[model samples]
Structure formats: C-alpha cells, structure tokens
Target chain A: MIKVQEEDFDVGQEIKNLTQENHAIGGVASFLGLVRDIASNEEISAMTLEHYPGMTEKMLAEIEAEANRRWELDASLIIHRYGRMEPGEQIVLVITCSKHRKAAFESCEFLMDYLKTKAPFWKLEETSEGGKWVDARDSDDTAASRWIET
Target chain B: MKILYFAWLRTTIGKSTEEITPPETVKTVSDLLDWMPSLGENYSSALEKRDLLRIAINQEYADPEHVIKPDDEVALFPPVTGG
Candidate 1:
C-alpha cells in the first residue's frame, strides 16, 4: 500500500505493520529521508515544498509497483510530506519487505531513487541573504536511470 | 488551460498558476516557452534557459515536441532535487 500525508508517522509501528504475520519475509529494509538543518553559509532559513495533488501520489505508486514486479517484495510503503518544513524534519519514508536482504535493500534504494527524480515535488528555501530558488538537480535523473537496467 | 509552476518558477513567474489560451499555431510545449517571453519580463527572466527547465503535460514527463492545447494542463519545474 502507498500513503502520502503531511503528518509525522511512527516508524516502528509502520514497520511492524509491514512485517507482522509474514513468516516468509526474512527482513525489512527501510530508508528515512531526514531533513537536515544544514546551516551552511548558504544562508537558508526555511524551506517550503509543493507537490502536484493527484500526480505525486500516482507517480510514487507506480514506483512501488515497479519495485514489486522486479523483486519478491511482500509489502512496500512510501510517505511524503508537503507544505513548509524545517530542517531536521522527516521529509520522506520508504520501506520494503522481501524474503531476502538483497531484494529488500535494492528495492528500498530503488524507491528512493525514483522518488528523488520522477516524483513531482518542489522546494523553496529561505536564506539570510534573501531567498533563492533551487532548481532540480540533473544528477537525480541520472540516478534513477541506472535502475531501469535492472 | 491550467498551468502550474513550482520552486524558483513560483518566484520567477510571480504567480503559481495561471490560465491561458494560445493560438492554433502553437502546437508543441516548446512553442509555449518561446511565447512566454512575450507575456512579460518576469516570464522571460524565469524562462531564461529552456534547457534547465523541465516540462510535464497532463502530469507526465513529456517531450519538448509533445502536442499542447489550450485545454491541456501544463506544469513547469526544475529537476527533482528532493531525496
């Protein structure tokens, strides 16, 4: 299942829900994208993120489906937040459950990689020297493309 | 005719969303970008470089040559930097 929300979730509870009663599942691999308040000399004070209402969720669901098709995943979850968020906030969470560690690990990373590039989300950061707009990084696209080979 | 902008685009466009109807000749998304500079200086500034901007039509990443219409919902943004 896929869930996209602005509220913070209990990571432990979510993991338990994914792994409970499934004896065939050997391990659960998860990745949490924590927003770091990197007080770089870049002068960024606050950050605001925006997403396409119907599109964002759909794209993430597609990514999850792809991972499931490639690996023997029992369950997968992706949750993302929108609106104004401070540094150190949890921006994204992805979990993958499979019978083997390799599939779980690879699928978790694959989901994050796809979300970083394909998912529709925008970020606006406020800095001391005035706010500057951040463009999407080309490197992210390259990162996601690597997964298509597998 | 729904147009969506995000990130620096929101600042550069000075507005997040707008509705517009273009001429019959403007068939592709590239045509829309080429026409945006004429709308105002702010649009020209934001669209300074077409190479850096990404385009999506109807919520899917589209080619520059993709057909566009006044009824289509087009979105513009920079590449994904979020992790």
Candidate 2:
C-alpha cells in the first residue's frame, strides 16, 4: 500500500496494522524519515513538500511492485506526506514484511533508496534568510543507482 | 498536448499548466524544449540549462528522445529531491 497526504502519521499504529492478521509474517522492518532543523549552514525553520498528485501515487505503486518482485515479501507499505511541515516532523515511512529478517531488511532499504530518487516529490526549505528549493544530491543518485541490475 | 511545470519551474514560468500544439518538427522531448524558448522570455530563462531539466511523458520519467504526441501530458521539473 501507498499513501500521500498532508496529515501526520502514527508509526506504531501503521506497523501494527501492517503485521496484523498475517500469521505468515515472521518479521517486519520499517524505516521512518524525519525533517531536520538544519541544512548545510542554514537553520531550517520549516519545509514544504510538493508532489504531482496523480503521478506521485502511480509511481509509488510501481516502486512497491518492483520491491516485491525482487524480494520474498508478504506485504509492504509506503506513506509520504506533503505540504508545509516544521522541523522534527515525520516525512516518510516504509515497512516491509516477510517470513524472515533478511528479506525484510534488504527490501526496506531498497524501498527507501528507490523512493529517494523515483518519487516525484520536491522539498523547499525555509530558513531565516529565505526559502530555497533543495537540490537533488549526487550521493542520492548514487545510492539509488547501486540498486540497478548490472 | 497538456504541458505542466512543478516547483521552481512553475514559479519561474509563472504558471502551472498550459495547452500547446507543436508542429510536426517538434517530435521529441528535446525538440519541445528547444522550441519552447520561442514562446517568450520566461521560457528562455526558465529553461536556461535544458539538460538539467527532467521530464515526464504521461506521468512517467522520460528521456530527451522520448516521443511526444498531441494527446499526452508532458511535465517538466528539476531532478527530484524527495525522500
């Protein structure tokens, strides 16, 4: 499952729901991303996330499908929030469930790496000086690229 | 075709969406980017480094050589910076 919204999400509730009623699931691995108070040398007061509505969800679903194909997984979930958010807020969540720990761990990391690049979302950081659009880092590209089949 | 811009591209272009019909010569995404500068100064400035821009044809990431059709939804933006 995938969700893009403007509201905050509960990490505990989300995990419980994902693992419930599935006796086949032996382990669940999750990753949660949070907004930081600083960027480079600037002090970030807030950030706003923007996304292509129809396109964001569609791409996310495709990414989930790809993870499933590559791993032995029972279920997976991705939730990303958009719009203005202050520092220390939750920004994204990824959970992968499988019968064992290895698949869950690997797939969770893979999902995050792909999400960082493939998702059609942008973030603008607001600082005391002014607001600026964040640039996509080469490190992020390299992280995602490593997952590519060679 | 329906062309859309997002984030800084939308702000720089001063609009989010537009409808345009390109001539037969504008057959690919790169061709459309080159032709866009002819529209006005905003197009030229916003599209200063065409190679830095990322495009999507019908909401999927597309390459410069991707074909364009009159009924497609073409979107342009900077490289994604999401997590």
In terms of DockQ, which candidate is strongest?
2
Q: What lDDT would each prediction earn against the true structure?
A: 0.83, 0.94
Model 2 lDDT per residue over A57-145, tens place: 99999999999999999989999999999999999999999999999999999999999898999999999888899998999989889
Worst 10 residues of 1 chain B by lDDT: B74-83
Residue-level lDDT for B22 in candidate 2: 83
Q: What RMSD does each model have against the real structure?
A: 1.8, 0.8
TM-score of chain A of each: 0.92, 0.98
Off by over 4 Å in 2: none
lDDT score at residue A20, model 2, on the 0-100 scale: 85
lDDT of 1 by residue, B27-54 (tens): 8999988888888899999999778888
Please, what are the lDDT tens digits per residue for candidate 2 over residues B1-83?
Answer: 99999989998899999999888999999999989999889999999977889899999999999999999999999988888
lDDT of 2: 0.94
Q: How badly does each model clash, as a count of residue pairs?
A: 3, 0
Chain B TM-score of every predicted model? 0.95, 0.96
For candidate 2, the per-residue lDDT at A117 reads 90
Please give each candidate's TM-score: 0.92, 0.98
Measured against the native two-chain assembly using Cα atoms, what DockQ does each of the candidate structures obtain, in the order listed? 0.67, 0.88
